[model samples]
Target: MFCGIVAGEVRAFRVTDEPDGVAFLDTRPVFKGHVLVVPRAHLVTLADLPPESITGYFGLVRRLAVAVESGLGAGGTFVAMNNRVSQSVPHLHTHVVPRTKGDGLRGFFWPRTRYADDPDATSYAERIRSALAADPA
Candidate 1:
């Protein structure tokens, strides 16, 4: 799944200028502004990611978390990941889901949603990308 996105074989609404990873909207989103940041390399889990790459990879995650909040006007963000046990895809991808007060989202068992169409998802991608570009840190 992620391999296809990294290879441009899959159609993903992508956020440009990702430093050490590829940024794109998640197909099943916890919220409207949910984004998935995945390393360019095919690392199956955090254990597979090399030590030297950790900082850069997490730097991108931090930026995306900020971008998701500011871009979507969310109160905050829910940034997390699943390892080998609950891993849906065999890729080390971090999920950055936008959060708002009283949005009814609770814990890891919250429901997910799909964008109405590509245009809708593209709007989110554009917002996050613009925010990411504007972010100097």
Candidate 2:
């Protein structure tokens, strides 16, 4: 349970319990209906994951993307995996961010700016949670 995010039982769009670890969604998200497909086993980079797990992980990501796009009404979605360079957490996790025009979020091209405070983070997380709960994909 990293960061206490997994405090109790929660629902996931998809779940794959591998020998090494498990992967699921981030109930709190940056964008509406955003999902984080992560391995429960701690691995810093994609290269560290087992070959079969890597393959299955991406497969789940693809499915999650389709769900986010269809269920969340996103115009598009962004899927990404990170190594040490941009990895905030040591665990290997993939981000499935749902995108829309005029959401005030620029694409990956633009530099990211920090939110004002906890309220901003809470607001964003709440919006995504509500959307996902209302219409899960």
Candidate 3:
């Protein structure tokens, strides 16, 4: 499903697209403006990513974290990924979610909620989309 998003065969509201990877807003986001950064190639796990490509991939992840914070006016961001354990998709992707104090986001284990509706989801995606444009590398 997501590989299609990376391949451009499917439509995904993208935040940043680089030679090594691409960052797009998560359809089911932990928070509004939450984004997922993934490698262009198909890699099941982080260990599968060649050592040489790690830095570049993570560099974009770092940039997205900053964008998540500044763009969404968040106090910070929650950046994480699951390897085979809780990995929803079998691809290597990093989640960068905007954070704020007392936002009810507990630890890594917390409740998940969907956008209020389609319009709400669209607004959240747009917020992150525009934010990415404002904060560039």
lDDT of each: 0.90, 0.60, 0.82
Better of 2 and 3 by TM-score: 3
Residue 22, model 3: lDDT of 88
lDDT of 2 by residue, 9-120 (tens): 5444333343333444455556545567676565678888888786666765666676667656789888887799867777678888778877776555523444455565
Whichever of 1 and 3 has more TM-score, that candidate is 1
Error of 3 at 134 (Å): 4.1
Per lDDT, the best of the predicted structures is 1
**Clashing residue pairs in candidate 3, if any?**
none
> TM per model?
0.96, 0.61, 0.87
Query: Candidate 3, residues 1-137: lDDT per residue as tens digits?
Result: 67898888888777777887988877777777888899999999988999999889998888788777776789999899999999989999999988889988877765566667767766666666676667666
Which is the better candidate, 1 or 2, if ranked by lDDT? 1
| Model 1 spans > 4 angstroms off | 17-19
Compose the digit string of candidate 1's lDDT tens values, residues 1-137: 99899888999899853549998999899888899999999999999999999999999999999999889999999989999988899999999999999999987786989999989999999999989989949
